[model samples]
Target: MPLGSVRYERVIAASADDVWALIGRPERLHDWFPGITACSVEGNRREITLQSGLSLPEEITVLDDRLRRFQYRIDSPFFPYHRGTIDVIALSDTSCAVMYATDCDPRTMALVIGAAAAAGLDRLTEIFPTPIFPTPE
Candidate 1:
């Protein structure tokens, strides 16, 4: 089956620079991403411990501070083809938007990942509240 993709976005009250500083760091993923109880990174490899105590391995494929974006791939036999990317776009000096995207084989995987992404964004809003007005076009 062809790969399926999902994208989720949330507006944050914090500045893009602030959000980037935190989210851009792969080691700090557990802070915002839901269900990630712990995270450890060595070089480009990362291991995340979920709430269920299951450890999932992932590889950091891209970390672009210039663009405030990062991409990672899950390493698991269960899902041979999986890739996730996160981008923080600056809507203003004190406001920004985060876009989380995932691509994986089997459409069902996209639904699961999309839920996780939505949950993560919901958690992030606690730190960065939703914008009152739409971000500038």
Candidate 2:
């Protein structure tokens, strides 16, 4: 099956380190993601429960602290796409760009995955604290 990809980017008023810190902590996902009610990580795998009482399982595929990038694969029966990546890049002292990308078989559930990503990003922006850093002179 051919893979289809979807991507979303947003500029957040937060440092890369700070954003990474927030993203890296699995247990804190609900704080930034609206639909997610809880998250738990066991070893390299994570389980996320949605507000709708649905639960999804994912495995950490890539975790590069130096580069501030992380990737995971969704193993839930609810999602067609089996994998996705979340990346955070420092744009400035007080700004960072977050990008989420997912590749899945278009024939299966591309639309669902895309819509969920968009909603998740929106919720993340709304719930997370604004980035803080020293003023650039």
Candidate 3:
């Protein structure tokens, strides 16, 4: 099966720690992520409810606190072949970037996943405050 990956980059006006704080907080996922109605984490597992009333359970596969990166795999009926990681990098004191990437099976599902990625990124940008980076040189 062909692996489909969509990447998005956004410069936020927050420090890497700040962004990570928000992203790492399971309860705050729906605040910036669209379609997610709620999130809960137990042990190394996490569950999320979608706006469509669907729910997904995922296991935390990788969590690198030093690098501020999180990776997980979906194991639920709500999504087919849904697995991804979110990476955050600090650009400066008041600037940072986030990237989300996913790989799934059933090549035909690429379109749907791609659309979801776009919408999710759009929602993230909308919910996040404006960037506070200094004027570029």
Candidate 4:
């Protein structure tokens, strides 16, 4: 079967620079990616621990500051063909849009990953709420 994919995006109230600083760094993935409890990276290799205490190995394919894009591939034997990409696009000085995309074989993996990616985007938005100011009456 061919690989399937999905992309999920969310607007975060924090600046793109702030969002990129954390998301672009593979070591801090658990901070906003739900179900991920911890992450460790060395060179281009990464290992992430899930809520179930299961660990998955991964490879960092690209980390471009100019494009604010982060791409990686899951190396688990169960998931032989999987790629994940995240892009932080600036909407304004104080806000940005986070685009999370995933492609995986077995077709069904796309649905599973899409849900996780959407939840992760939601988590990112929740962490950076916009401030509201009162107007003079």
Candidate 5:
């Protein structure tokens, strides 16, 4: 079956290292990711509880510090295949771009996960507020 994919990017006024420090950790999803109420990670596996009380299992695929990329695959029985990737790209010393991408077999799952990903990016922006520049005299 062909997979459906979606990608969302947000430019945050924060260093890439700082951005990665928050979202890069698999065990910290509940702290920032919208809709996630709680998260428990053990070894390479993770279980997340949603605001709706639904729980889902996931597998941590990649956590590359140097590249600032975090990838995971949803291991829920309902979906045949689902993969999510979060990448932080450095735009400058004090700015970076966050990309959230999702791939799913059912196609519609992509839309669902994509929306949540969008909100998660928004939360990241809120957590790392844009820096204000001082006006020249």
Candidate 6:
């Protein structure tokens, strides 16, 4: 089946290293990702609890500190095929860009996840509030 993908990016006034420090930890999803009430990881598997009290199981497929990126796959009935990645790209010494991308089956699934992803990006700004001037590319 052809996969559907969605991506969202945000520029934060912080170094890439700082951004990575916060997001690199798989267990910290609750801190920046909206609606995630809790996150726990065991080996490569993770469980995330939503505000609605729904728990979702996910597998940590990739954790690349060198590239400041990590990818995970959701194992849930709602999305039969789901894989998501978070990447932090350095834009400047004092700023960086965060990218969240997801691929799933039934193309329309991307839209459902994209809304939460957008809110997650918004939550990131709350953590790093110094918004730099030059727009992100």
Number of the top candidate by lDDT?
Answer: 6
For candidate 5, give the lDDT of residue 57.
92
lDDT (CA) for every model shown?
0.87, 0.74, 0.71, 0.85, 0.87, 0.88
Candidate 4's residue-wise lDDT over 1-137, tens digit each? 78889888877788999989989888999888888898999999999998988898999999998899999998988986899999999989998888988999866988787788889887776677752222121
RMSD (Å) per prediction? 2.6, 4.9, 3.7, 4.9, 4.6, 2.0
TM-score of each: 0.91, 0.79, 0.80, 0.89, 0.91, 0.91
lDDT of 3 by residue, 1-137 (tens): 46666555566677888888877665667777777889988878888898889787888887787788888877865446767777879998876787777776654445565556556655655556775542231
TM-score of 1: 0.91
lDDT of 2 at 72: 85
lDDT of 1: 0.87
Error of 4 at 85 (Å): 0.4
lDDT of 2 by residue, 1-137 (tens): 67777787777786778788987676677777666788998888989998889888888888889888888888866556567778899998877888878887653455566567767666656655553433221
lDDT of 1 by residue, 1-137 (tens): 87888888888888989889989989999998888899999999999998888898999999999999999998988877989999999988898889999999766888787788778877877767666555331
Q: Over the stretch 15-45, how does candidate 6's per-residue lDDT look in tens digits?
A: 9999899999999989988888999999999
Residue 63: error of model 1 in Å? 0.5
Give per-residue lDDT, candidate 5, residue 83.
90
Total clashes, candidate 6? 0
TM-score (C-alpha, index-matched) for candidate 3 = 0.80
Native-referenced Cα lDDT, model 2: 0.74
lDDT of 5 by residue, 81-124 (tens): 88999999998989888899999978888988898988888788
